[model samples]
Target: MSSDALAELSAQLPGDALLVGADAVEAYRRDRALDPTAGVPLAVALPRTTAEVQAVVRWAAAHGIPIVPRGAGTGLSGGASAVDGGIVLSTERMRDLRIDRTTRTATVQPGLLNAELKAAAAAEGLWYPPDPASYEICSIGGNIATNAGGLCCVKYGVTVDYVLGLEVVLADGRALRLGGPLIKDVAGLSLTKLFVGSEGTLGVITEITLRLLPAAPAPRIVAAWFASIEAAAAAIAEISTTIRPSLLEYMDRTCIDAVEDLLGRGLDRDAAALVLGGSDDLDPDGRDVAFMIDAFRRHGACEVAETGRAEGEALAAARRAAIPAVERRGRLLLSDVGVPLPRLGDLIAGVDAISRDREVTIAMLAHAGDGNTHPLVVFDPTDAVAAERAELAYGEIMSLAISLGGTISGEHGVGRMKRPWLREQIGDDALEIAERIKLALDPDGILNPGAIFEAR
Candidate 1:
C-alpha cells in the first residue's frame, strides 16, 4: 500500500469518495465485534453507485489490494474487519430506494439501514418481516450478507427469503444482476440466494430487490416466567411443536437482571427464565395464545399473562435490548449458536454447564421458537484470566451446538472469529467445495479477504 498506489486509486473516484490518513480511516477498521487483530486499512472507499463500486473493485484488483466490503459497521461478527494494506469499501453512501406497490418489492441500495427499509416499506402499506435486534443500526446489506434471522423470522423467514434479486460487483469489477422482483423465477441457478449470506467473500452487493408483504396483523403477546430454565425451554419446545409463533423469545435470569439494571424495567430478576410468545394470526379464537399459555402452565410457569399491545411491544423491546444491556456488565464474546427444536433444551442446559465449568457469566437469550440462542459471554477485558475463560466458554458453546446437530452460526455468518469452528461443523468436504466456489468467483481473493474463508 504505497502512497503512490493510493494516489493512483484515488484518481479513479470522486475526491470525497476516497478517505485517507489514519484519522480518516480509523473508524472503518472494524465492525461492532471490535476484533482485536483487525488491521489498519490503506484507505476507505465510500462508493455511492454501482459504477463507483466497480471502479473501486477494479482499482483494488489491479493493485492486488484486498477489499473489505462494509455496511454500516454493525455486524456482531468481525466479517467487516479490515485487512492490512487493504481498502475498506463502504456502501454507506449508496442509499437509494424504490418501492413497486404492484410488484410488492423494494429495490434498494445496500447502504440503507434495516429499520429505514422497514419504515420505507411501511410508508407504502407494505411490511418487511425480518427484524434483527439491531435493525435500527444494522444496514440491510449486512442483514443480507448474514442471512439475518429475527423475531419474525420464525414465522416469515430470514433475510434471504425476502431477497429476490441482487446487483453484485464481482471481484473482476464485472457488475452482474442475479434476479428480479418476480416471485417465481426458476430460469437459472439460485445465485441470488447464494449471495444472500455470502458475507462479501464472493462479491460486493451494490443493490438488492426485496420482496414485501402487506403488514402483518397486530400480534397478541403471552408472557411467561418460570422457576426453572428447563421448564421455560420445555414450554418453548411445546409451543413451537404445536403453533407457529410470530415471535418466541427466551431470556435467562442473568439477562433479565442486566436489562432491569439498564432500563429499570420491573423484570423478575429472581426467575430462572422468561419466555415470550406472540401470534399474529387473525383467528378470533386466539388459538395460538391459548396454546402458549397452556404450554407454559403445563411446564410449570410460576406466572403467565397475556400482555396488551403496548405492553407486548415493550417486552419485545426489552428482549431486543438484551445484547447492549448485557454488554454494560462487561466485554462480550457473543455466540449465535442454534440447535434443532427438539435439542433446544439440551443446548440451553449444555451452555449453562459450560458457564459454570468455565467460571464465566454467560447471559443467555434466544429466538426460542427457532432454537437460535445468543449466549453472551461477559468478562472483564482487562482481566486476562477472565478474558481467557470467556474465550473458552465461547468455543465450548459453539462446540456444544455442533455436537447436538446444530450450526455454529444460525444467522451470523462464519466471520473471522468463528472461521476456525466452521470446518469442524460443516466438515472438510463441504468446506473444500465452498472454497472451490469462492475461488471460482473471487479468484484473487480480494473481496472481503479473510472473512468467511481465510486470506490466501
Candidate 2:
C-alpha cells in the first residue's frame, strides 16, 4: 500500500485508532497460533465506531489494499494473521454495548469481549451461552467470526445460534444491517447467519444483535476418572445417547498433568482420562446429578464423585483452564476437529494412534458430548526435527478426522493454517458455491483476504 494513501486513511480515524510504527504493528501480526510466516502489515487500524471502520475499508478498497479484520487477537487459528503490505482492521476500540431487557437481546460492537457481554447479561438476569475457553480474553466479534463453541454449547448451542442480527461493512464500504431484535422474521435470505461464520472474508462486522436467555440454574457437577481412553470415550457416547447435560468435558492424562503442574490441583495424573458432567436442571432435589453419577459408574468409571455448587464450579474452572495450562508445556498447534456422535470414540482412538505413530506429545481435551476435541500438539521451536513432526502430525490429525466422516474444523473456521485441507473435506462443488457467494459480497477481495478462501 502507498504511504500517501495510508496517511490519508490514518487522518480520518481517531488518533488512538491508528498504529503505523513497526514495533506497534509487530504485535498485530499473528494471533494465538504465532504463525512464523505471517506478514508485516502497512498499518493497523483500530476503529472505535462503525463510521470509522467504514472509512478505513473504503480507503483500503480504493487503494486495493487487503484488509484483515481482527478482534482481540485470541484466535487459535490464524484467522487474524496480517497480510504483506496490507492493512489490519482491528475492532479493539469498538467496545460499545447496550442491553435491551424487553427484547431479550444485546446490541454490541464486535470489539467487546465475550466475558464482558456475559457479565452485562448476567447483571440483567440474562445469560449468554457460548463460553469459549478463551472467553475471558477473546472478543465477541471474534467468537462470532469463528462460530465459537464451548462446553455449554453441547446443550445451549454455538455462537451462530445466539446471533440475531449484524451490521456489516461490505468490501465496497457499504454498511448494511441484516436483521433485528424481532426473532421470527423470515424477511429474506439468512444474511445474518451467513456473516456469523464467514471469518471476515465477506465483510467487516461492526455491530451484532445477540439473543439472550434467562439465567441457567446453578449446576450440580459429576466427576469421573477412567482407566483407559476407550472406556472414557464409551462413557461419553453413552451419556450423549441418554440425557443432554449442560456441560460434558473430557481431558486425557497429558492435559490433566499439565493443569496439575500449573495449578497444583489434585488432578488424577494416573488416570487415562477425566470426564466431567454438569446439570443445571430446575429440580431442587438434584435428579440430574444422580443420573450422571449412575451413568459414569455404569460406563466403567474408576471413580465417580458428585459435588454441590462450589465444588462443581471449581472442577469446571479447571476444565476451562486446560488450554492455557497445556500451553505452558511448549508451543502448541491446537486442533478443533469434530466427528459424528457415534464415531466420537473412533476419532479419539485415531488421534491416539497418530500421536504414537508421530512420536509427538499430543494432549487431548474436548467438549465430549458435542464430539468437538482440541488435540494440542506440543513442540519446541528450536528442535527442528520435532517441529517438522509436529507440523506433520497437525495435518494428520485433521486428515484423520475427515477420514472418519468428520470435519477438519468444527468450531474454528478454516483459516490460513487449515485452508489447504478445506477442499479435501468440502468437495469442489461446495467450495465453488462458497466462492461464488464470497465473490458476490466481496468482489474487490479487500476484506480478510487469505482466510476461509483465497483472495479473488
Candidate 3:
C-alpha cells in the first residue's frame, strides 16, 4: 500500500506491467456499475502471463494488499471494483488464445473478448454459445467469472456450461489446473464448475478451457407486441413450457421506449410489452414459430409476426443495446433478479407496483425463457429524493424475486453491489459453507476482498 512496497512489487514484475499514476489508474477503478464508493487503488497490474500473475499475487500476499482481478471492466455488477490501497490486477494484456479443432475446444487467456473468441471458433466451424449482451466488450474470463448467460442461453446454456477447465493462481501465488478437454472427467470434485461463477474471491483466473459445439443454424425470430405485460408473461410461460426456444425475451414499455429513443427503430412506443421468440432449427413446418405466434395471439398480443435471420439479428442487437440506451436517460441501478417461470408474471407485477410506490422509472427486461430479469431503475443522481427512491426500488425488486422463490442474481455475479442481499437469498447455511471454502483458498482474504464475500 505504500510507495516503497509498490516499488518493490514493480521490481518483481516485468517492465511496463504496472500503472501507479492517478490518471492512468482512474479508468480501472470502477466497472459499468460505477459504484460511487469505488476506491483509488495503490496500482493497476497488467500481467500478460500466469507467471507474471503469480509474481503479482505473491507480492500482494506479502504486503497483505487486496487484489481485485479484472477482465474488460464491462461488468454491470461491481465485481471488479477496486479497494482503497489495493492492487487492481487487470488481465487486459493477457490476450492469448488457441483453438483445438480435434477436441473442439478453445484454450484462451482471461483477457480475450467474447466476440473475438466466438469469431475464432466460427472460423474453425465451431461456436461458443454463451453470448452475453455485452459480448462485444466483455471478456471470456469475466464470462467464466460470472457464469454469464445470453439471449440464446435458454437453449445453448451459460458460460459455466461451456467452461471445461481453468488455470487459476491461488491466494498464495500457487497455480492450479482443474478439469480438461475430456468430456467425461469425474476424477475428483466438480472444482471447475465451482470457480466458473465464484467471481474472484477464491483466486485469479489466468486462462480458461471452453467446450465448443458445431455451429448452429441461423435462427428465425418471432416478434410479438402485447397490450398488457400480464398477457406477454402468460405467452412467455406457455411458450417456455411447450417448446425449446433458442431465445425468449421480454421488454417492458420503458425499455422499449428507451431503445426506440436511442435507435429510432420503429418500436411500438405505445405497446405495453414486446416479446421476441427465436428458434435455430429449420423445421419444415415452422412449428415453433407458429406456436409462438399462436401463443402471442392467445394471450391477446396486439401484433405478432415472424421474421428471417437478417431481421432477427437486428432485433437482437437492439435488445443487446437496451442497457446502454436506458443509461442515456439517467443513472441506472440495474437489478438481475429472477423467479420461477410460473411466477414471472407476478414478479413483473410486483416490480410495477414497487415502481409506482417508489415513483421511479423502472425499465424491465428479461431472458424470459429462463426466468431471469433485469429491472433497470433510472434516476437523476443530483436529485437526492429520486436517487433514494431508486435505491429502495432496486432492493425491493430483489426481495420480490426472493419472495417468489427465485434468485437475486441469475447471471450477474453477487458483486459488492449485491452482496448485502446475497445472504438473504442463499440462506445462512449455504453462505457459511461458501465462506469456509473462501477461507480455505484465500486465507489472507487478499483476493477481491469485497466482491462475493467480506474480507475475513
Candidate 4:
C-alpha cells in the first residue's frame, strides 16, 4: 500500500482511530499465537462504531488492501496475524451492549469481552454459556469468528450456538444483517450460521445478536486422578456413554505438572491423568453425579473426590489456568481436535504415543465429553532441533486425529497455522466449494487474506 493511500484511509476514519506508526501498530500484528512471521501492518484501525468500520472497509475495498479483523487478540491460531501492507481492523473500541429480558437476548458490539458479557447477563439473571479458557481476555467478536468452545460446551454449546444474528461489513463496504432475535427463523438460507465461523474470511463482524438462557443451576463437581493414562481415558469414555456431565475435562501428566508448578496447588504430580466432571441439573432423581462417580470407579480411578461448591470452583479454576500455566514452560502450537465419543480413548492414547516418539513435551488437555482436546506442544525457540521436532509432532497429532475419523479443528477455526492441513481433512471437492464461496463474497481477496484460503 502507498503512503498516500494510507493517509487517505486514515483521514476517512474517526480521530485517532487509525494508528500508522511502527510502534503503535506493533501490538496489532499478532494474537496470542505470537506467530514469529507476523507482518507489520500498513496501519491499525480501531473503529468504535459500525459506521467507522464501514469507512475502513470502503477504503480497503477501493485500494484493494487486505484487512484482518481483530478482537481481544487472544486467539491461539494465527487467525489475526497481519498481512504485509494490510490493515488490522480492531473492534476494541466498539463496546456497546443491550440486554432484553423478555427475549432472553443480548445485542452487543464485537469488542465486548466474553467474561464481560457473561457478567452482564448474570446480573440480569441470564447466562451466556460459551466460556473459552481465555474468556476474560478474548473478545466476543473473536469468539464468534472462531466459533470458540469451552468447558461447558459439552452440555451447553459453542459460540455459534448462541449467535442469533450478525451485522457484517462486506468487502465492498455494505453492511448486511444476517439473522435476528427470533429463535427459529428459516426465512432464507442459513447464511447466519455460515458467517459465524468464517474466521473473518468473508467480512468484518461489527455487531452480534446473542441468544441467552435462564442462569444455569450451580454445578456439583467430581475430581478423579488415575493411575494410568488409559484409565483416565477409559473413565472419560465410560462417562460420556453413560451420562451427560455439564463439564467433562481431562489433563494429562504434563498439564498437571505445569499447573502444579505455577500454582503450587498440590496436584498429583505422579498421576497419569486427571479428570474433572460437573453436573448442573437440579435433579430430584440425582443421576448425573452418581453416574460419573460410578464410571470413575469402574475405569480404575486411583482416587475420587466429590466436592461442595467452593471446592468444586477451585478445581474448575485450575482447569481454566492450564493453558496459561503451560505457556510459561515454552512457546506452543495449540491443537483443538475432536474424535467420536467412542474413540476418545484412542485419540488421547495416540497423542501420548506421538509425544513419546517425537521427543516433544506435548501437554494434553480436553473438554472430554465432546471428544475435543487441546494438545499443546511446548518447545524452546532457541533450541532449533527441539522446535523442529515440536512442529513435526504437531502435524503428527492432527494426522492421528484424521486417521481416527476425527476433525483437525473442532472449535478453533483453521486459521493460517492450520490452513495447510485443512484440505487433508476436508478433501478437494469441499475445499473447492469453500474457495468459490470466498471468491463470491470477497472478490478482492481483501478480508483476512491468507486466512482460510490463500490469496489468488
Name the TM-score of candidate 4.
Answer: 0.99
Models sorted by TM-score, best on top: 1, 3, 4, 2
Query: Per-residue lDDT tens digits of candidate 4, residues 221-306?
Result: 99999989889988888888877889999998889999998888888998989999999988977689988988899888989989
What is each predicted model's overall lDDT from 0 to 1?
0.92, 0.90, 0.92, 0.91
User: TM-score of each candidate?
Assistant: 0.99, 0.98, 0.99, 0.99
lDDT by residue (32-96, candidate 2, tens digit) is: 98877799999998888889989998898888989999999988889999999899988998899
lDDT by residue (tens digit), candidate 3, 222-319? 99999899999999999999999999999999989999999988899999999999988788898998898999999999999997777788889889
| Model 3 ranges off by over 4 Å | none
Which 10 successive residues of model 2 have the least lDDT summed?
A: 1-10
| Candidate 1 local lDDT, 1-456, one digit each (tens) | 677878887898998999988999999998878899999998999989999999999988998999999999988889999998889999999899999999999999999999998999999999999999988898989998999999888899899989999999999999999989889999978988889899999999999999999988899999999999999988899889888999999999999999999988799999999999999999889988988898899999999999999989999999999999999998999889999999999999999999999999999999999999999999999999999999999999888999999998989888898998998899999999999999999998898888989799
For each candidate, C-alpha RMSD in Å? 0.8, 1.1, 0.9, 0.9
lDDT of 2 at 95: 93
- The residue ranges of model 2 lying beyond 4 angstroms of the native Cα positions read none
lDDT of 1: 0.92
> Which structure is stronger by lDDT: 2 or 4?
4
